[model samples]
Target: MQLHHSIGGTGFPILCLHGHPGSGGCMSVFSEHLSQRFRTIAPDLRGYGKSRVSGTFEMSDHLLDLESLLDRLGIDRTLVLGWSLGGILAMELALRSPWRVTGLILVATAARPRGSHPPISWQDNLFTGLAGVVNWVKPGCRWNIDTLGRRSLFRYLLGRQSPEAYRYIAREATPAYLRTSPTATRALRQALRAGYDRLGELETLTCPALVLAGERDRHITAASSRETAGRLPNAEFYCYPDTAHLLPWEISDRIRADIDRWLDAHPEVLRP
Candidate 1:
């Protein structure tokens, strides 16, 4: 598929996968930090960014693309960090090719589709309204993610509402949103809403994982995140209080530090 990717620094490899309506560039902040100690490989998932959109727009297609990318890079195995939609793909990759996955770091993701939930927070409700307006106007645009990244009205929707955090995310996330194709955005969203559950299968995944979510996240509720961590035999779940679904971007530093500690603590999951 000739996926466009960003690779920098040198050490152990860490393939970072981004979320919905976002390209590999969305994870640039996290990758920048990790690049100092690890070879950070971030790719624009098929259909997003500069990657070509060929064949079926399904999760299986992405999985194969990732495998091919690894082979092309001559990487036998490596740690993977997935955010949101990327998190789901990472779990699937671990299940499909356990030997190729050293460890997993899933952020702002859940094991299965969430059914009903409590009343939406005002911040999230406002976001939904704005998102609806953007989706209505552009149909497949990044749901106005560029504006969301820059505007303080939506800053509270993220984990950290500080000006520094907002600026940090705006720099990386805005480009990612701009790079995403409408076709890619629709395809991934459709796949996620298709009602497929892998809860039963998670019990068999033996590789260590770190499942992270935010307390104020409405996309994937905290309960779902906890259940996901509980289902996996070697998974650890952590929730940041008052944080929203944008944990990977909002709490990038903390997430990065936690990931470093996690990998160090689980040497068994490191590639030999």
Candidate 2:
């Protein structure tokens, strides 16, 4: 199945994958920054964004879509940037097609995300209401709002930046969040609850990797992200304080700097 994607710039290729319930548009900030030095391909994996939601899909299916995408693009090898669920897909891709992935930048993700299913609370409903109201007042968002954003899941996507940064992120991300497919969201939730973990098959490929996490991330534990770096043959890891799952946006400057430094360390990422 063809996937909807956003492509920009022209340099080293970097495949950007967003988390579940998120669209390629959510990664636009990172893509914009990286596009100067790298070719970024951000895709709305199988069931989100403008991509029509077909029936439920499994991890392998996502992997296949990515592989096919790369093949169609005529890219023999590329750098990878994955966030949350997207990070899992990156790891799987590196393992499945070793030569295809030259490097990985993983954020707020774990090798085997604990299969703990969080129950809905009043907070979720409260945020849902807040999101609904945002849509109510915003003329552009009147008819488009997915009121299923659960607590930090929404804020996590929005990021815990300064008030100005928060508004900036929210203005751009709210619509992306609202466009999330309900069926896709439910499928991902159930998959997590069903304890769908393939940990034994996990291993970060030999390529250099940069694993980052937030000390305050409640969704994907920092320990797990650090452990992922440990298991990697060549990897660097960092965990920021006072940040949550939205490290990509919360400390986006830091992440961008780190990406630059890491690329310098692994010069192979820049060469053909």
RMSD of 2: 4.4
| lDDT tens per residue, model 2, 68-96 | 88889988999999999999889989888
| Residue 220, model 1, lDDT | 75
Model 1 Cα lDDT, one tens digit per residue, 1-272: 77889998998888999887688888886789889888999999998877867555767889989999999999988889998888888999999998888888988888784633355467665765665455445543442655543242354456555544445445555556667777777777677678767999998888899998888787777778788899999998889987877776667778888888887899876665
Q: Which clashing pairs does model 1 show?
A: none
For all predictions, the C-alpha RMSD in Å is: 5.6, 4.4
Where does model 2 exceed 4 Å of error?
Answer: 115-119, 135-161, 202-204
lDDT of 1 at 131: 52
Candidate 1 CA-lDDT value: 0.77
Query: Model 2 clash pairs?
Result: none
For all predicted structures, in order, the TM-scores are 0.83, 0.85
